[model samples]
Target: MKKVVLAYGPRGFGNYTFDTETLEFSGSPDTRSGPLIIPGFIDIHTHGAFGIDFMSATVDEMRDLCCELSKVGYEGFLPTTVTAPVAQVRQALARLPDDPMILGFHLEGPFISPRYPGAQPQGDIVDPPVGVSEWDPILDDSRLKVITLAPERPGGGDLIRRLSNRNVKVSIGHTEATYTQCREAFAMGARHTTHTFNAMRPLHHREPGAVGFALTENDVFTELIYDRHHVAREAAEVLLRCKPESRVLAISDSTMAAGVPSGTHLKMWGLDCHVSEGTVRLADGTLAGSAITLLDAFRNLKEDFGWSTAVNACCINPRIALGLSTTEARTYLELDPDLNIVARYDRKK
Candidate 1:
């Protein structure tokens, strides 16, 4: 292995150094003429990018998507699943590529609430089954990292405990659960919330729904899509202020339309999604998944909030959220003051 050191920042704020080979950081400022190094972005929630959807992608297609994501500096990612038939979801999982970039799988549907199925195929949405035996094929897979579901649905709390007992992270999302219901779910073993305020119930003063619960609860980690379109800058600022730095996860939630031209039209989730004006929308004008990548979210957070918030949300929080170990080789994105990825240093390479 090569002895590589990456340096960034100026005086006062202190210099950040990364040991590419060991994937460790040294805070002591050093006068080294090297590019700024940030942890390789790990996107915990992403459907697809580069005009490929994980739900219908072949192994080669998924590998192609992985290559495309590496160009944008994603060292690790979770190939998230959308709400689809149980059989279809199983097929998708079986077909996932064994790329080094693929940390695991994020099962994001089927057991979600139809009432808050934002852009999800409502026809396929259903309540959790009474037992985990019915989904043994999925639950048995050790690669299953996170599963997003509505805890207010039938057998939802039981499912949460079952999945948590197996060491699989459960996230609350696409629900109409109020504060009390969310608390109950948390007590049952759900420790995360998907996309924060998007598909769940709104934060009412009297009700303090899922969004409210996620904010006030320190133990619960919240995933925030920093695509300026899915979440406004002002709202993101408010989230940064309200949530603890360690508990906020910055995710892309990007779909197939990302990395394509604005005029591109793609079919996803049985709907015609058009990518334009930095946003993705269906024919009926409902906002679909994001067109931004984790890199974009990192830049947005840094620009909209600050470096501290961006690093915590994009880098440190993701690994903590998934309970992943970084003892293996890691990749680092060497960025400039403008947040441009000028170069990359991969320890494995």
Candidate 2:
């Protein structure tokens, strides 16, 4: 098999070679493309896009989402679930066909706090199943990568330990957990934070809740939905400066309402939401989610921070958080000086 070389620079990382057939890295750089090349994006958090919710998607609909995301430079993603009944969540997972683009499921649900529920349905928030074998379906699924929960909830700590012991990554979010609670969860092996600063308790001088714990705890990884609407530029800068760039991950946290017309109305998880001015919002103006693609997030970050920072957050950072190996693919993007996609060479089976 011929190895394809991806040369990207002005920032100078030299070339990266990949075996076209297997999409695995070959190490030595040989030139097949030049100027700018980057790995395909890995989105660890996203509900659905183009009007499909993973929670209710048919097999075809889920596969279609994979195709749509691939066109936008996403090589892998996690189909996130909103707070729902265990049976419903299980049904969605059981029905979802295995697609190459779907790395895993990010269960962002029922095991959360009702106080900081954000866009999640309040009625669905409940204690995690306490019985060790109760969630065997989820615990046994190899594709179950991450689970986000509020540690302050009943049985949250035990569940966290159980999931971590099973090799599932636990993330803390959608909570009103105090600083002490956050620390305890971190100690229990919840190493990631889901959409930091949005649904969690805010940072206060005396309190310093989940957000504070994420920043202070160097071992924890933080996911930021850097779509301007979700996190302001100034605040993003603060996060960037405070946390090691490698420890921070950029996610879309997008809803199915993304990519549709601006005025399109969407009924998400039984709540009425509409896409307006590139943002999805509730009827009362609470921010629903972002319509921004991973590409859009990269472009926005590059314009604001510079190439290295943007690439780190969008590409490198996610890989680190997910413990992904570089040998996964040889796919590369040819980007212009301004970081726009000039062309792309994808490795398709």
Candidate 3:
């Protein structure tokens, strides 16, 4: 059988044959329609899917999340915790199992701006870690990979420097910071932006906020929740136009409400949220997270943008942000003519 592989070279797809019995490539390339093979998706920022919230899920429940995600072609993911007390965050981080599919953990934060808490637990929002207190045990968790905070807040810069020193990605989010402040944070060590253009200040002609910097900067990895509701096509197009393929990280900042039917009300990490037309939001209409998987993101981006846009943003870029081995990146999907995932498997042993 012939297959279209794009991971090797992003310029375009190349046709290759596979022996059905041996499950290995058997023949040279040919120019014809065939199943598409792209790298497996890696979700660096997902709260949960299929009704499980990582903020409170047990190890077994988290495994169940993996099973659900794998069905759609996810090779790896980071379990993200919504804003909560420090002790509570520790409990959430400690329960994760040592599974290959589980990459690390993301803290969406206790260290965020109350002015732009979004759907996070507002009352639990705390100051950025100063690294000199007993209540900061959550920072000691080896599995902690990413932390999102408001750089305009006190100690935010210091926290970014410290986390960066330890190789933990500091993603700027939940802020009302100006472009100058955003630039300062970048210079101080923040390298990622959590779900750009959401839960942060909007751009102005005179003072282009965090969104401006995220769009124009080539070095920062910005996360986009490609679910159309979270970000519009025009805005996403602008982002794509300004940043290179390598710097744009598409994420499924999904929550328990994701994939559930519209109007389904659920408590997400203690906040009442509901789904509506595929967008998850709080009671006051603040977008809680998203109701999309990487598969959904990939399809939307591929349909709206192009194949390479989808492949780089959904599959490869997140891995790059996490410092994972791309050459050995396993997990590939066999797609039919309609772009449906017909088969999924590991690519490299």
lDDT of 1 by residue, 159-193 (tens): 89989998888999999999999999999999999
Worst 10 residues of 3 by lDDT: 3-12
Candidate order by TM-score, highest to lowest? Answer: 3, 1, 2
- Write one digit per residue (lDDT tens) for candidate 2, span 191-301: 999898899999999999998888888888899998889889998898888898778888999889878899998888899998998899999999977787788888888
What tens digits encode model 3's per-residue C-alpha lDDT throughout 206-260? 9899999899889999999999998999999999999998999999998887668
Error (Å) of candidate 2 at residue 274 is: 1.0
Instruction: Please list the C-alpha lDDT of all candidates, in the order they appear.
Output: 0.84, 0.82, 0.83
Give the lDDT of residue 25 in candidate 1.
60
After superposing candidate 3, which stretches have Cα over 4 Å from the reference? 1-12, 17-32, 347-349
Q: Name the runs in model 1 displaced over 4 angstroms.
A: 1-13, 16-27, 30-34, 325-329
lDDT of 1: 0.84
lDDT of 2: 0.82
